[model samples]
Target: MAQPTTSILCTDLGFEWPDGRPVLSGFHLAVGPGRTGLVGLNGAGKSTLLRLIAGELTPASGAVRIAGELAYLPQDLTVASDQRVDETLGIRAKREALHAIESGDVDERHFAALGDDWDVEERARATLDRLGLTGLHLDRTTGELSGGQAVLLHLAALLLRRPDVLLLDEPTNNLDAQARARLYDAVAAFPGVLLLVSHDRELLERVDQIADLRDGEVTWYGGNFSAYRAALAAEQESAERLVRNAEADVKRQKRDLVEATQRLAKSAAYGKARSVRRNDPKALADKLQGKGEETAGRLRGMHTERLNEAKERLAVAEEAVRDDAEIRIDLPRTAVPAGRSVLQLERVRLAYGGVVDLELRGPERVALIGRNGSGKTTLLRTVAGELAPAEGMITTPVPMRYLPQRLDVLDDEATVFRNVKAYAPAATDNDVRARLARFLFRGARADQQAGTLSGGERFRATLAALLLADPPPQLLLLDEPTNNLDLASVRQLTQALAGYRGTLVVASHDYPFLREIGITRWLEWDGGELHAVDPR
Candidate 1:
């Protein structure tokens, strides 16, 4: 293999939000050719850095240098309903110019538009096919495609541009298994500088290198996600060991300081008694006493300084160890008896034509798995009473709550505390704050407006509102809950779900996340039918 060429560079970059919240400062990065995975905790400025590199946001200082053309694919991709497939691929104009010139129209503008790109259509089709989009037509409207298809289409557009540097933020967020596989193949084969920010472990595993961003700094790890994890584990173990040693040193320093004080006290007393028993001159005895006191004071000061130094070292050692917090709470009100049926779907036909006959008894946890257009979301909404079934009877005897993928349950203008309070009107203010603290929104964080929160913070606030409802939901419905969450936030969510004793029906494409949440049952939605399956 040959050495890769540098394509993207950042020097002394700085950025801050309008609210005076600093995100990145003096950040420097040099990205070369090959796929690089960017991983970080939520609110760690991963997206912000990408936007800076893509020229989507202006840095407060320094500069971003790109050796060639750059293209960026964001997490939330939105195309107009009327946009045609060819238009989205950026070949509509070129195709029209090529046709006109072939038909003997001598126009300079047409020649200029078609310049050296006569095979644009063929390349577009090939790219589409490569991404498993062979069924889509050039003139098909974007509105006809599924959410996962839209994401793939956006990536196809970026590929069509053939930029030297490519930036992708959560590219596999809404994709199903097949689409995700197609995307992975594309990333593996791309011949340019690729920097992607993602929490998808599978996707991260495909990268050539890993960049772990935290505290406004980037640490490079050789090889893929697994390699990064191994390296990080080793680093953390070393840090923990250093912390332990530093703590022991501090304790020893304190003990030495106390022993020095005791020795000095004994020496001073012995000298004073000897001087008094020997009947020395009063002036001489006073001088001797003064000299002993000064010596003891100097010794005490030296010992105290050593102890302080040891404590500072301990503090620095502790700072090197990462301590990501987990969500832990009790939900006694949501518990259900083992034999009680919380939900029943009797030969039900959803509005989208999916058929299901199921019973959720006790506090069973169900994982709904399927492709993007396979009616998983439709079925979840129908079960949550957000959508009515076309046929059959569905019953939910207990209180339920639905957390949609969009997370639109809370008012954006209101504070997080206010949103939780609205959901549980009967709960006291102290009680609501106490509950929000468990979700990692304490103090002024709970007072921040919902619109101002980061993606993970917003999800936490929405979850807090749902879980803190007045009557307490016994059947919690979550749709693609891990879509935009970072790895830390995903772990936190898994921890939170583990404590919930209510029935859970989570529709997600994240297999690791689903498994981590301790799913008791698995159901696959395919061709409008629900079938039980073993956990993957």
Candidate 2:
């Protein structure tokens, strides 16, 4: 039974390029009224499929139909460099109002809807505040917002639209845990069809169902991403077992055929001996001849059929396996020597725009975990020597490097190789160039402008440069290093950090990632006095 006021459906869906090459082929999906996480590798056309479903782009083949308005939130939600947060929110409100007026029943001389005329301006301001975009001048142009703020503003606008479907690509990316939690709450409460693409394991684990795009089509599993992963692992194991069995069957058949052929040969010899002397072997000779011929035929027929079966079985078994595009990362390292003091903070205090008491410190990788407005960034700034600890004594080594939550240290105009040379001036082009390759920025990509790189690529580029530094910064500070990174890159970084002999301080929400890097020391900030606790 199908219950549907409005549901999306696709059958034998497909799309291809102008050259008759397929981007998606024979795709099929049935999206009900729930959140579905789109899981696939980088180039799996997940975003393209979302666009097709939203009617933002038409499929070249087959059908993509939705009955109501849809909202699309792309991964790269950067506004034009000059758009102000308030102005953008206003535009969104006005658009929604116009859409409502156009579609509402009162368009042709009918009474207007009973609701009050929505305040686009006030509501726009309210929307920004709700998304932590308060205090920014509405009239200020878009160019002024920080990269993270810009992303947040776009998200606020998208949410205000209240469309019937949401196609979000990496919505939680680059946001801290609090922001991510807020995003999750919004998605959970949203009463519409949602299809989003993300590599965040935690984010995907909460979706209603998972839609896996593999081999040119979508496969729907009626559970969260974790369940789907478990099922996939089981399937992979089963496929391997089937392959082994099929191989063994072929070997057994070969042995049986050899035995049969030897029996036939022996029977032929007996027949010849009986026939040659004509020594009272009359019926025996005739019987042996007839039996040998029959046996030979049977053996030939059985061997042929068995061989064919084995080949077919092997093919079927092989097709069940998936390609090995597993995520991988390798962090470049120039090690740091251990010292008695990695970092020191005393009776620290912090506040946003005058708020203050967020003391922090660590001689090792220290984690700062708390809700938003809890001063995580404030604490990081204080440690980075960027902010003056208003009420406490903070001491840090003069030569430590800070990788801010946002990559503010790198120049967007410079290529990765150049960036490294600037940070590590003593290094040669060849040395820096080779270092970039280990981080996946090879050759011309190493020469690509930083401004043109993706969020993940930028993270890699910044970290690569840090590694090339002359002293490699005996102390390291990372703010959400895993955010926006694909799983492979994360693994690479994890492996690199596992062996590094440096002091680390991190402000992140990823508990697992924190645990992996060996956070031997931790400080929890509660209304601003650092409480020491063993993170082990």
lDDT, candidates in the order shown: 0.90, 0.70
Against the true structure, candidate 2 reaches a TM-score of 0.64
Instruction: State the lDDT of candidate 1 residue by residue for 1-536, as single tens digits.
Output: 97446588999999987666788899999998899999898888888899889888899999999987889998767768999999998889998898998899979999999999989989999999999999789878887576788889989999999988999999887799899999999999999999999988899999999999999999999999999999999999999999999999999999999999999999999998999899999999999999999999999999999999999999999999999888998888989888799999999998868678999998899999888878787888888888899999999999999998778888988999999999999999999999999999889889988976767888999999998898999999999999879988998998888778899999988888898888889999984888899864
Model 2: weakest 10-residue lDDT segment is 353-362
- Looking at candidate 1, what is the lDDT of residue 202? 91
Candidate 1 weakest lDDT stretch, 10 residues: 1-10
Model 2 agreement with the true structure over 1-536: per-residue lDDT tens digits: 95455567777777764444356777888787888998765446776677677676667778877757777777656567766555576563453454566687455322233145445557667767776667766667876454456666777777777777778887775566566766776777778888878877777877899988877777778788789989888999999999898888878877777887788788778778867877646687678678778878987788878877887898899888765332233433434444456566655555343333332233367777655445666667777779776666667653578888668688987777888889888878888877777777777778877765656677778887775577766678787787656565577677656645567777776778889888877766654556676644
Give candidate 2 misplaced runs (Cα > 4 Å). 1-30, 51-66, 79-82, 91-116, 121-152, 200-206, 226-237, 254-308, 318-333, 340-363, 368-478, 485-493, 499-505, 523-536
